[model samples]
Target: METLFWLEDSIVGMTVSSTQWGYPIVLSLHAIGMGTLVGVALMLTIRVLGFAPAIPVTSMAPYWRVALGGFFLNLLSGSALFCGNASELFFNWAFRIKIVLVLVGLALTWWLVQICVKRSDQISPAHRILAALAMVTWLSAIIFGRLIGYWS
Candidate 1:
């Protein structure tokens, strides 16, 4: 609690919280990152789940680079966004849920990537499950993230 309050009161937080454009800019970045991350994840997951059998999963390999970039961008922007309201976010149940979902989503995305790298021809049942889980995790994270504002 003390640490969160300290972060909320820190220079970075103050700038984000007080500046008229700062919060919005950071938030917009976060949204862009989210779109990239979730959109690419969904596309890959759909391939793994055998939606578009014509497109080889390996062909989607380049997307992982884009997804990783999005993840890093989200990490940076989300951290700044969190800093702006650390005290409240730290105590928000929805925020915690969002974090967990994102972590799980990341793990699932990793597994999906591994599957793609190994056997892009015919995906196994496990790969399909992981792909489905990834979709659910990402979507749930988005839902929980949206709920954070209402909850806090």
Candidate 2:
């Protein structure tokens, strides 16, 4: 309780919550990061599921750097956002679900990436299943995140 209050009272939190432009800027960056991270992952997942047979799965490995960049961006921005409302968000069911989904989605994505990078040939059935799970997990995370504001 004390820690949450301190976080909410921190400089980063105050800036994000008090300044009109601050929240918008941070929220926009979060959105951009989410789009970059999820968009690239979705593309790779689709390709692995046999959507674009022309593009080699191995070639998609290079795009992981873009996803990593977005991940870092989100890490920074999300921390700030959370600090701004630490006490309330900490108890929010939607926020908790979103965090769990993000973790699961990240793990699934990493596993899929390893398979894609190691095997230059066709993706195995198991790997395709992992990709599908990652897709669903990430999309669920997004939906839950969006629901946080409206959730009681």
Candidate 3:
């Protein structure tokens, strides 16, 4: 408790929490990061699932760059947000769930990337299943992220 309060009182935390536009600006970046992360993820997953047969799966590979950019952006912005409300967020169930989901989702995405890097012409059942799971995990993270605001 004392630690959280201390963290919340830190310079970065105070700026995010007390400044008129600081929180909103960080939040907007977070939202854009989420959109970039999930949007690129869905594009790759759907392509793997054969949504657009004309576009080769290898072509979709480059989009992972955008996803990674979004992930790092979110990491920075989310940390700032967490600092601003450390005690409340740390104790929030929804925040906990969101963190877990995001971790799992990122792990699954890494696995999917490994599979893609192999560049197999044939899409295995395992590859399809992994892609599907990644999509679901990311979407669930988004849902729980929103729930954190409402439930916390």
Candidate 4:
């Protein structure tokens, strides 16, 4: 598409593709963001599933801010990376699957968070199921994202 070509040829794309440090730095940041986001989600999901009954679920609520920060970081860095190779990525099956998984994971995460926050004292089986689903979805998204590098 013309738009993809334009984005790939844009200044941001040029910097990411041309500069020696640009791609690495942005990619590293993306990884850090993914770790931060997924780590928090996993921790929260574990807690919600009653792994650490000693710790209150309400305490985990604040970590959502950290997850949100990581999401924004990923959004920005991912955008830059995509701009660098929009044409290739746009048609990449792995990339498309990753995007869908991310969306579903985010929805599940939000639902899990709401359950945790609203019923901190009582985690129903449904809540646990949601938390497990969120964990799996997030992990799958990460896997698909990694596959993008080798998907060709």
Instruction: Name the lDDT of candidate 2.
Output: 0.90
TM-scores for the candidates: 0.95, 0.97, 0.94, 0.96
Indicate the TM-score of model 3. 0.94
Clashing residue pairs for model 3: none
Clashing pairs in 1: none
lDDT of 1 at 86: 96
* TM-score of candidate 4 against the unseen true structure: 0.96
Q: For model 4, which pairs clash? A: none
Instruction: For candidate 1, give the lDDT.
Output: 0.90
Tens digit of per-residue lDDT, candidate 3, span 1-152: 99999989998799899999989999999999999988888877777776877776777667788999999999999999999999999999999999999999989887887686346546778888998999999999999998998886
Best TM-score goes to which candidate?
2
Candidate 4 lDDT over 45-138, as tens digits, reads 9888889898888888889889989988999999999999999999999999999998898888878888776556688898899999999999
Off by over 4 Å in 3: none
On residues 59-101, what C-alpha lDDT tens digit does candidate 2 reach at each position? Answer: 8888998998998889899999999999999999999999999
What CA root-mean-square deviation does each model show from the true structure? 1.2, 0.8, 1.2, 1.0
**lDDT for each residue of candidate 1 in 1-152, tens digit (9 for 90 to 100):** 88898888888788789999989999999999999999999999888888878887888888888999999999999999999999889989999999999999988898888777555576889888889899999999999999999996
Q: Can you tell me which runs of candidate 1 are displaced by over 4 Å?
A: none
Please report how far candidate 2 places residue 133 from its true position, in Å.
Answer: 0.3
Q: Looking at candidate 3, what is the lDDT of residue 88?
A: 99
